[model samples]
Target: MSTHDVKHRLRQLRGLPERVRALEAEVQENRQLNRRIAELTDIVTELLIPLEARDRDKVAEILERYKQGL
Candidate 1:
């Protein structure tokens, strides 16, 4: 009805595009970070593959020795 009201509504509509772009950018960044996390987890899992054992005592002993200055 008024010039000011129309201008305010247009500004709000224009702001929606900027907000959408920001959300899209954040989604892309999250995807990349998730991929990196998976890669690092796999690498660490591979490195520690030999450390997994059915023997609890062996794991405990190793930790104890490490805590008591080797």
Candidate 2:
């Protein structure tokens, strides 16, 4: 085979592992981000209301000052 043909075949066949590694890294990053979102959602949905209500006066005071600044 010609050098040119041999080089072309090698180039086409050599990139599989690198591409697979890149895709696996992205999948892991996405999984971590998804887990964080789930944790935050659970906090907001299941725990935030009573926690806020227990300190309703403080929350209202903070909101009043925040509104005044805005």
* TM per prediction: 0.53, 0.52
Which is the leading candidate under lDDT?
Answer: 2
Question: 1-70 in candidate 2: lDDT tens per residue?
Answer: 9999999989877987898999999999998998899878866665555457668787677566555754
Q: Which residue pairs clash in candidate 2?
A: none
Predictions in order: lDDT: 0.74, 0.76
> How far in Å is the alpha carbon of 9 misplaced in model 2?
4.9
Estimate, for each residue in 7-67, the C-alpha lDDT of model 1 and write its tens digit.
Answer: 9999999999999999999999998998899877865564345347646787676556545
After superposition, the stretches of candidate 1 with alpha carbons farther than 4 Å from their true spots are 1-6, 48-70
How many times do residue backbones clash in model 1? 0
